[model samples]
Structures are given as C-alpha cells and as structure tokens.
Target: MTNFSHRRVKTGSDPRRLADYAALRNELAKLSHPARPDVNWQSVEKRCDALFEQNGVELQSAAWYTLARTHLAGLSGLNEGLSLLETLITHQWDALWPQPVAVRMEILCSLSQRMQQLLRTFSPSDSDYSALNLAEQQLTRLISALQRRELTPLSPLNALLSLIHHSAVRLEKSNSAAAPVVENDPEVVLTSTGISAAPSPETTRSANEVKWIYLVPPEPQLATNPQIPPPAAATLWQPFALGMLAMLVLGSVALWSWSLFQRPDPLQTPLASSLSALPSVLSPMQLETLRQQGPLSDALFTATQQQLTRLSQLPPDWATDYSRQLVKQAQLLWPEKSRQLTQQWQQQVNAAALPADTMNGWHQGMTELQTLADKLNALDEKRGRYLTVSELKSAVFSMMTHFRQTIPVEEQLRLIRQLPDDSPARQQQIEQAGQHLRAQAYALMKEKEKETTAASF
Candidate 1:
C-alpha cells in the first residue's frame, strides 16, 4: 500500500515536471524565433559581456547574455541595474526557466522591486519615455513568459503577480468610487456562459470568420411565386414637380416685366381721364411699376394737384355728387363686379386705335392723369374731407384698371391711409392742408369779385 501511494505521487509529480519542460521548450522557441523582431541581440550581448567579465561566469554568447541579466536582477544592492535586468528577463525567459525555483523567485522579487523603483524615475521631459514604455512592455512580456512556463500557476509566484494586479484594480476602484453615481440603472446582464442575452451570432466567430458576418442586415429575398410579376419600383415624381415649378416662376417673371413696361394712350378721353386720376394711398412698389409704365400719367397727376383744392370749398351736396360721378366713371372703366367690362374696353381700344395716334393720346392722357393724380394725393394727405365710401369704390376700380400701377409708398402705408381726410369730422383740420378744392374755390370766388369791381371802375 505504501509503495502504491508513493508510485501515485511520483506519477502526479512527473507530469508536472513534463508540463514545465514542454512549456519552457515552447517559450525558448518563441524567444529564439528569427522573426521575433522585438529582441535586441547586440545590446543584450554587450550587457552580458560586461556582467560575465565582472562575475567570471563562463557561458556561450547567448546563454551568457541570458544568465548575466538574470543574475543582475537576482543580486542585492543593484538598484540601478534593475532596468537592465527587466529587459533581460523579457527576452531571456527561456534561460531563466532552467534555473532553480529559488533563483526564479529571487529574480521575480527583484523585478517587482524594480517596477516600483521605475515609478520615481518617471520624468515628463525624459527622452527615454519610449524606453520606459518598452521597459513596461518587457515587464508584461516577462509575466507572460512566466505564465508560459507554468511559473505563475504556482502558489507563491501566482500570489505575487495577483497581488500586483489586484493593487491596480483597487486603485482604479477607489477613483471610480469617488465619482458621483451617474447611472441609476445596473449594467446589462449576461448569460451564465458569459454571453449577453442579445449577443450577436457573429460575435462568437473567429477573427478570420468575422468578415463573412455583415453588420448590416442582408437584402430581403423576393417570394418564389411564378404568377406575380415583381412589383414596379416606386416612381420618383420629383422631375415633373420641378419642371412645373420652373414654368410657374418663368410665367410670373414674364407677367411682371410686361406690366411694368406697358403704357396707356392719353388721347382716349375716358381712358386718359382715368389714367390721370390715381390715389395717394398706393404702395411704393405698385406706384413705381406704374411710373415706369406711364411716365406721362405721373406728370399729368402732378399738374392736377397744383390746380385742385380742398373738398370743403365745394357745396356739401356737391361733394357727394362729385364722389358719385367719380365712382360711376370708375365702375364703367374698371368695374369690380365684372372683369370682362375692363377687358372689353381694352379690346375696343386695341381694335379702333391707330398706333401713332394711340401713342400720342397715351402721352397726353398720362400728362393729365399725372396732374389729377397729384391733386388726389394732396387731398388724401390732408386731415379734412377727401374720399368718401363712394370715392373708395372709385379708387378700387382705378387700382384694378391700372393693375400695372403701384401705390406710391409702402403697401402697409397705402392700407393705413385708405380713408381720405375730406370727412365731416376732419373739416376742422382742412386749413392745415394745402392745395385743396375748397381753398382753390375760395380763391376763384375772390378773383371773380375783384374782376367785377374793376369792370365797374
């Protein structure tokens, strides 16, 4: 029974040694790989030569290099040499593996001490920051080398590495714990097998297989039914809509240009008279368009302003009568109820008129129109009687007749000043106004009386 137990123990022990041997051989192959570009042979050789010459250890070039660094790290009172030892340990793990456990432990202890020592040497201005980074990289490599050789799987060495790793974890935990709680929700749960519930089927694929798994969903396949033709692709109607919008824009531009340039004949009596009279309450754009179309009309309107005076000068009944006459004329020329009447008038003028006579008449009509326009404007500006309800009807008709015409100021101003000042309530303010019909009438009456006295003399 004793012999069997001993045999069992030996069997268990044998495989562990074999495992160590196999792992070490693999690590050696990795360290010695020709393609392993990280290992620097010359610097390592130089370091080993210096150490071996001092220590009197006889070894081959590579073996001496490996053993020399391992000794430098394992020795006491060599604090500055730790960096050199760290580099050697990373590149020469194969050599270290053949050493006894005591030696390996001593080397690891030295490495850990060296790591702590390096933290103090961290200078922001140091050109050797890359070397330091390389040093850290080597430390990582050494730890991995140990693992490859089953060194980290052992109790004491494993515990030491774990202690270092855990310290880093604790430091990170302390910092994160100091932060205020940002998330009210817990982390997403994973399955028992470490998969998230919504784990991508492709996530488990090997690196080489990853390319085959598209992040985007695949296009859907059509049904295999023979009877149905494939549904027609949705037609893009954008071109048609754009074409229609373009046509509308062009039409509007053409209309605007025609209206702006078109002029009226001034010789035609009713048309000329209508053109002569315009309201003060026209919008600036509208007024500008009309002025461009018929410059003669504007001149006539100005002359009329110089002639006519305030409505208050007229008999109260006469003011109403004049308003009715103007309204009736406006309806005949530019009727609001029927646009056809205005169109018919235009057609008649086109049919009967000679081009030169029409042109000459238009010029004269525009001049008279401008005169009357100025008079109407002066009346409209005053605070006294000017337009009544009947006159407003007349003005609307005039605006429609001269659709090409614009109010002489801002559109908002024309709207605001639509009601004329010759109203009864506004009579008190009539004297403040200049060039009104009443004022003109009073002057005329005084002149007539003076003429009678002269004749008597």
Candidate 2:
C-alpha cells in the first residue's frame, strides 16, 4: 500500500499559475477523502454526471477529474461508515469483521462524536444524518489511506480477541503458558493410514494444537437475563450498559403490567354497599321531609288510597289476612289522609251511574275498582320483605301513566313532581329500568333496518 499524502509534481510547464501548483497540490493531497468500500460506481457516476450537467460546470479540468475520482473512491469509506451505523442500529458490534485496532478506536471515537451530534433532536429518518454519516466515513477512509503503509495495524475486532487471550495468559500463566517438556521416544506404526501405535512427540504436539473460535454465549452459559451482555471490566461498558438499560426498561414494563393485572375492577364492587350503614332512625323534620319526597311519598299515598278504596268495595269477611295487613300498614303510615283519599276515590267510582240498559259506566268503574284491588293484593304479598318506599312507588307511578298520556305537558310535569326522592336505591333502579326500555327501543329500530336491508337483498 502507498501513502497518497504527497502533492502532484509540476514540471514548470505552465507559467500562467500564480503559485506553485505543486505546493497547492501538496495541501490538497493532505485534504484526503475517505474511500467507500461498497458503493456502486456506475450509479455514482450517473449521479455525478447529472450534477455536473445541472451545475453548468465543465468536466474537462484536472480539478474536476480529480474530484470525480475522489467521489468514486469515497464509496468504500461511505460503506464502512454505514456498516458502523448499521451495527449501532442492530447492536451487533461483536459480530463485525476484523478491523485494525487503531481504525476501530478511531471509528469508536468518531461514532461517539457523531452520536452526540445526532442526539440533537435525534431522528433516525433524517436525510441530513445519513449524509453526515457518509461524509464522516469518507473522511476516515481518506486518513486511513494516507497512513496505510505505516505497519498495517491489526484489526480492532481481532485485537480485542487478542486482548482476551493475553488477559487469560496473564491470569493463568503457569497452567496455560508452561508448555510440557516432552522427551522424544521411538515411534511405531499401527497401520499404513498414519495411525501410530506409539505416539511420537511431534504427532502428539500437532494433535494438541487447538484452534479456538469465539461464538455468542450459549443460552445456559448466559445469566438468566437474555438481554444482559457477558461481563467485561476492561473495555468500555457499552454492551453491558446497553444490556442494563434494556433490562431496566423491560423490568419497568413488567412491573407496570403486573400492577395493571393485580388492580381490582371498579364495576366488580358490590352495588350500593357504601350507603348501607346510614342510621335508620330520622328526626320529626327528617321524617316529614322524607314523606314529601316524590317517589316514596307518592307510592305510599297512592298505595294506601287504593287499598282503602278496595276495602270499601269488598265485604270485610271477603278480605284476606294479607289484605288486612296491608290496610293496617297503610293506616299506620297515614291514618286521616288515607281515609280522606279513599272516600274521594269511592265517591268518584260510585257517582258514574250507568243506565240499566247499558253497562258502559258500570264496566269503567269496575275496571278502576279492579286495578286498585290488584295493587292492594300485591302489597299484601310483599310487605314483609320490602321495607323501602321503592316497592310501593312503582304502583303509584303506574297510576299517573294514564293521566300523563291524556293530560298536557304542564299537567304531566305536575304529576311527576308528586314522586318521592327518599331512596337513592329506588331512584337508581327506576333510572336503570328507563334506560333498559330505551335500549330495547333502539334494538328494535336496528332490527327494522336489518329487515329493510334483507328485503332489498
């Protein structure tokens, strides 16, 4: 290999030059460009030609010719640099081919600097970064070429392996370095196939000459962590540092995942469990307020009135033990008011007198009487288990349904205002029921759309 760090000699043939062209050439030689080992020359030439045409420059000058040649030479250096960058990307530095030790050191130093620059808003996709990498590679190759003949340094990759061997020899000097001093003995031939009956010292020595090649550590030989690199104390902590970072990131993710899996679902909590421990007893004002609550008060008032009206309609002997219990409970809740409401409803039913020839009014009054009777009957069945106002509220709320359908919006609002608000549980149940009804309606609408599509098909 020859050093290309000297100037082009000028033979004083061109006197028009202001300075010695040789001196300028010498400086230019020092400004060497790196070689790219794997760049495609055909493609580069085409690109260069296009650039020259675009730039409106003559390609006849010596400078232009040199520049073109330099550009082509840069391909090798560009390739080498790209390989390093690729190694960083893939993290397979140990797997790279043997490189000169100094070259490797220079590469590492240059890469460290380059990485710092790249870390400025480091975008892997940046075209500028790639171009800079190519430029650096070209520069490194140029320097290496200038110093190529100065005792070719050992490959950095090989040097690293040599270092390992050296370290091993240093540690186990006696056992590894001390060669066995063999006394030659007479050799005997076993067969014509070079098998010795009595081993010659030379044959044994040759047989013992082991050649070792390094391979990636096997799974069992490695620590439990797959990401961790093999321990190295002397070299830069690059591989180990990378491994530790990877392990840390993985560990954090695992911890986060475990926490998520261990966490309890909010929906799984028992329904209304928080509110179960409230005091059952209320002050007089609290009780009064509770009675005025829309749903609770409405259920109690309407259920009581209906029961009393049914009692008026039926003979005392005809009423069951269940009905009697409901009547008693209603009376305890509202004695005078229940009586008054029952009287008013009975008067309304009775006043609708129908002609003996027609059963219209009679049928209508009997229907109302039957509805009231059924409500009282249900109350009789449920009183023991149903302490909350929610149980009775539905019955009273249903009575307002017919009125709501027939009345104006203002009247409907007034009717709704009569509902009780004493029980949160009852309110939630009612809201859920309404939502279910709405969902069903939407489902039916969807079904209709599907049917329409089927018909078209």
Best by TM-score: 1
Model 2 segments more than 4 A misplaced = 1-416
TM-score of each: 0.18, 0.13
Native-to-model Cα distance after best TM-score fit, residue 325 in candidate 2, in Å? 50
Cα deviation of 447 in candidate 1 (Å)?
99
Q: Single out the weakest 10-residue window by summed lDDT for candidate 2.
A: 4-13
Candidate 2 residue-wise lDDT, 179-223, digit = tens = 433322223222322212121121111332211111222233444
Q: Report, for every candidate in turn, its global Cα lDDT versus the true structure.
A: 0.41, 0.40
Question: In candidate 1, what residue range of length 10 has the lowest lDDT sum?
Answer: 2-11
lDDT of 1 at 227: 95
